[model samples]
Target: MESFGIVKAKKNNKIFVEFTRESACGESCESCSAKCAESEKELFEFPNTLSADVGDVVKIKTRDRSILSYKFIVYGIPLILFMFTITLSYYLMSKMFMKNIELMSLIMGIISLFISYLIIKGIDHKFQKTNKGDIFLEKM
Candidate 1:
């Protein structure tokens, strides 16, 4: 994905860029009917490869491959984990002659989802601290 932002700050070899909704809106807003440009601003850090200064507009790029991995982490892993846990719990409960095996499996699945959520949140926190990611920036 490609986006445009204005450099918000500079520190060492890193530059923080701020992207507003209007700047990210690609096409002419007047002709569009979709409720596309929500009011928000996103800040991202990138290597200072372009030697951009504060208040300068820059172009940011993110590879499609990296995006796919992010999608899997945010959506796929929890779903897969839930399914696996539910199936495993159901089989185990059945073998143990437990009553309400379906209910037990559902409860186990929900528990697994909660665990996955914590894991994902930790990963997100670590990434936020490091500020090291796949974004590439250049002067516009």
Candidate 2:
């Protein structure tokens, strides 16, 4: 079975889709990892597809008991933490030393942001090799 969804938001280049429980997947299913311990109301973000914009409807095919895509987890968490730590470290160090904290924080934040972008882009490239959805987008 599959799920039909509508793109609700786009942030940092990722497309978020809102899928209802009444779709083919049903309101109660043991197939979804997110649903196994939570409610059926779900939002999925495809970090790769850029062809569709916000408000576009999408279709996603799911196999019973399959895991939600791990592209985000494997890549996103690390990138975010890296950026945050870098920025925070800069801020803290400058504050403790009574240096130009704001400027240092700003500069480090910008650099960390770029690093995060590169990390995410690399992960997207890696996902493209193994996942078809990472490379294509369509409107339903």
lDDT to native, each model: 0.85, 0.68
Give lDDT tens digits, candidate 1, residues 1-140.
88789999999999888997563465557666774754579898877888889999998778888788778888988999999999999999999999999999999999999999998899779866774567666698
**All candidates: TM-score:** 0.69, 0.39
- After superposition, the stretches of candidate 2 with alpha carbons farther than 4 Å from their true spots are 4-59, 63-79, 95-98, 133-140
Best by TM-score: 1
Q: After superposition, how far is residue 59 of candidate 2 from its true place, in Å?
A: 5.4
Number of colliding residue pairs in each model: 0, 1
Worst lDDT window (10 residues) for model 1?
21-30
How well does candidate 1 score on lDDT at residue 73?
85
Candidate 2 has its poorest 10 consecutive residues by lDDT at: 62-71
lDDT tens digits, residue span 1-140, model 2: 56678899888878888887663443566666665445356887787354778888888775433234454655666567667866787768876896777677667766766777777678669766766543334578
The pairs that clash in candidate 1 are none
The best candidate in terms of lDDT: 1
Candidate 1 residues lying further than 4 Å off, grouped into runs, are 21-37, 114-133
